[model samples]
Target: MTKRFMTTGLSRRSVLAAALGGIAVPALATRPATAALAVGTAESYVPIAVGAGGGPAGSDRVHVLKVGPDTAHTVLVLVPGMFGAANDFRLLARDLVAQVPGVQVWAFDRREESLADRTGFTTTDPAAYYLDGHYRSLDPATSAFAGHWGLARTLCDLRAVVLAAAGGGRRRVVLGGHSWGATTAMAYAAWDFDGSPGYDQLSALVLMDGGVRGAFAGNGEPVEDSPEQVRERLAAIDGGAVFDLSLSAVGLGSRAESTQIWYQLAGWYAHRDPDGPSVLQPRMPDALRPPVPVTNAALLGVLVDSGFGWPNDISVHSGHLAVSGDVRGWVDTGITPISRVATAYAGGPEPAVWEWYWPARLSVDLDVADAYTDTDLTRSLGLRLFHSGGLDVPLFVFQTSYAQGTIESAAREVVASSRIPYAAYETDNGMNHLDPLFAAPERNTLTTSLPSFITGLR
Candidate 1:
């Protein structure tokens, strides 16, 4: 393995060339030579300042990648799932733009928990950091557990970014998300913050593989981890627990597959931050240290163990890693944990895995637990989509074959409750959670189904 060094402000052309195994990509006449780009594509980052509402004041800089020209009348803002970051959607966004002319696709960088940090985890390894930082950023003082971290504030952040992307409300916006992002999109649709529904801000909602029901129990109860479980997980973050790396192999297929995934994502992160010193070392193959920074202790724990009772949604099959016979059974039998063999950087002197402590327990977890235990149903706090109000605007749900049952039920519930037109497209494609966004085979489905869905909104 040869190490490739990036100079200060490496251009998109150079980044793409190196990312594609040194493929020579010609520079475009329209854009600058040193722009950060996706592999084989020329998507560049546009910074959107989301002020105030987006946790910890002073305008959090949320970078959005724009694909295609902004001449399109409507903008589709897609948020990524658990570990899914903006760069993950680059290839898909480029493909969509090429396939669906006149419609621009914008993918948002995940919002980080506003904590003072110098690890560059947010920029280098967002998938692992955002999930952890979110839980760590929760505080009882500001009511973030129920308010800021909830869908309402999320909508605020989305609105801020949408407005910035649309160049001050010039274009109509349609929102879409995959997995957890899908659920976020649905929440934005049903949210009623200022006496009016947030749905008014968007033209339509495109949910891929997830939605409101993802956080709810079958009996309408909030799905969450118990306080004891949350505590244990938090402790695990401090003490560090050995996770089954085989679980990662399930979703990513193999170590090489996982490396590619990390490579693409890390490359995007690195490209975006050309001015800062490189967070990754020279050709670090220690799977954990593959140019991508390791997640903090809290984030690693939350990602590996808890959160909505379905931790590591990005990894493992059927969303059940603990009890599932295939994966967990192997873990119980002392099968070599995936973390051990999947990457050589598992445990060593000064290991990068879970190096920092997140201190407080996640507010989002407490909020969900409170909603579950509270006797007064009205007082319960959770995602807006699962709440009472049904969307009045056009709602489109794309339920993949292996979509979570909670999400499926939530979509059905919204359909039953919605007085307005609600449509659900159930496809037989055997896609695990993340396939709809990353899998090239499904590009046809996305290009055809999504564009038509958005156009139908007109």
Candidate 2:
């Protein structure tokens, strides 16, 4: 009811507070104080992992990030996308807490995160873990146990997080996620928890630019990954190549995930030393490197902002490199600050924002997706998506420009078949895959709409 998240007359806009050195947080921004509100939140992580024999040392103990007061009545549990960690939703969690008086956000790091080596992030120089390889990555051989980190294991562990959020049925819970995380939400809804349907435990669902459409929409034609194909992939994982930084399926090439850490380092450099010479540049191939020598922020802008000329679907409208600087500078688009993007990647000692060692099996199991978890094969694969069509919880879907087709179809099918109450909104401005989470507090569509959705639920 209170519009405290937005203010009318604010004139100064600055970036990053003087922390240990730098943090691209929008300090005293000219607009509403939404971006500034991101900082100073009480955040903590607690291990709530389930299942047996997970990868790495502590990979079995998945940590759920808890933001906001424990007294909040409603909890929105979020799962990150492919190769993602809980910190990915840090901005959104802070924003949600600011807007709603009674809501809390619970986000979790996936199982394979145990493979991410954050040892490099602690070094004095961000580039210590860069191309020269000062921080050696985990040997894929050591992570052979990830071969069993499939949807089944993930769901079982996530169920523990959800149950903790539920607080022994005392708190109302809403489930949600981004990209692959959103798809995981759908799978969880369809999933059968013991004998009970997954949807029975939640009050509502929030899908941000991710959904399940016609995964197996064909009559008799085979799905993307058959049972035999899944078996062969598992055999390969057993042979030692456990980490899956490959993203060839998106036509984006294997370079996508392989260079994901380059972003973590790049973001750190940008936030730590915005004006410093680009540490990420030297590590990049000649083709991907900026044509002209650039600064740390400029290199980050090049990687994520399409306006800077890199052509990829993951690009969002963060801002452009300042044209005047001889070494190039960054200008925040105001929609999502470039500094926020940098902070999201490499700001502090928080849990990793990117999962460098994404389990190959989770993606493999999803290739044979069952839209509603209504198939016998779905149970066999451990997906447990038992009955999505029967979902009775309120559905809130916010479609973005980057990935709308599948979300639209999925929203339509669920609303029609289940005849449940639902709300669907479209992104008018240029919003990308990652924008919904990082957009400025007031300008963020989710921050503005989610409170009403959560409160409106019956």
Candidate 3:
């Protein structure tokens, strides 16, 4: 899916009117009252500096936010989704700290620095010049992962935060993240700490609705060539010129023109009501079609084995090769194991759905059209890595009815086929793709489910 930024032209009022037409706003306010949790009298909330990290290649100085009390036993590190800042978790963090006293909450300011400053490129074109530059620079050795700000380097930073907060005391430190941040925490768990000092520090990990997939792995069925390849093919079609002649053909040149077109489309979808109660609600604006043609040509290029490429034949070691197999088999077998354990605490599915039609709004000013590409690549990578034994750790797969059908089905398939032991929970509430993290009151559905799984970890 192509990511576009929502422009001011697509105001909420105008979008709502167009999308909803005669429908009246539901009198039943969607917002639910905050759930009350028992704050133990023995624990106290303490004020502490919560550290934040810049996006890739960011600075060393953590953007510290004050949260919680020092006497709490659990420290939670919150990571945000693409284009999200530390404050996005404020409502959820406030509630979490209140329940688990002495909980030190920290979130990173990924956007504090310009994308250029962090990724080393500058342009305002929404065609993803930044990602093109980034992947081109990926080298196993001498990459940022080895540097102070690399992924492993960030793990060190996290360890420091936990130790300082503990102050010679042993406390439960949980690494939690939303979207990309959640993937980062998972990557940290997968990091090869053979040479890194102080590797065994993390007590637990929480993936708030994020997991490894896509480009993180190499084994999945072959996808259509990467987006960079698609751009190249398009360029070739235009007589070897690097510029996108398609834009010229469409008569969209200035940022304003693109913004206007994007806003109208995004606004409509963002405000549109679903035709019925189902897993797949229309999240995209009516104006936009799937960016790429959903044709045989396109499917051939992108459709591959969904299990991130874990071999279907289970002769290989239990790590990477074990998860590989028929996508349906994996999910089918895997779900049974988790269902056994989750049945005790599993609640009915709370299905909620959100369509951030203009996901690229924040990055559009910087001409970063590939804002969502990273996620796509990440999902691809995750499929391959997890299947190849890169992810052998205990995993708790949470499925909600609100997920896009394709994604939800894929999750179900993988869980059913897996041989390893894990837990699965199908929520009772209406939780959608974005609602798991973006919605405030419903966030507990995620936190509570996670702690229940982790607290049982050996």
Q: TM-score: which candidate is best?
A: 2
Tell me the spans in candidate 1 whose CA falls farther than 4 Å from its real position: 1-42, 53-59, 113-150, 165-169, 214-222, 225-390, 404-406, 441-444
The CA lDDT of each predicted structure is 0.44, 0.68, 0.33
The alpha-carbon RMSD values of the candidates against the true structure, listed in the order shown, are 14.6, 8.6, 16.8
Q: Enumerate clash totals for all models, in the order shown.
A: 8, 6, 73
What is the TM-score of candidate 1?
0.54
> Which should have the higher TM-score, number 1 or number 2?
2
The TM-score between candidate 2 and the true structure equals 0.84
TM-score of each: 0.54, 0.84, 0.45
Q: Model 2, stretches more than 4 Å misplaced?
A: 1-39, 215-223, 226-235, 238-241, 247-258, 309-312
lDDT top scorer: 2
Judged by whole-model lDDT over C-alpha atoms, candidate 1 comes out at: 0.44
Q: Cα deviation in Å at residue 22, candidate 1? A: 30
lDDT per residue as tens, model 2, 53-170: 6454566677888898899999999988766788888888998887777888998887666655566678887565545556547667666677677777888888888888999999
Q: Can you rank all candidates by lDDT, best first?
A: 2, 1, 3
lDDT string for model 1 (108-132, tens) is 7544422323233334355455323
Ten residues in sequence with the least summed lDDT for candidate 1: 327-336
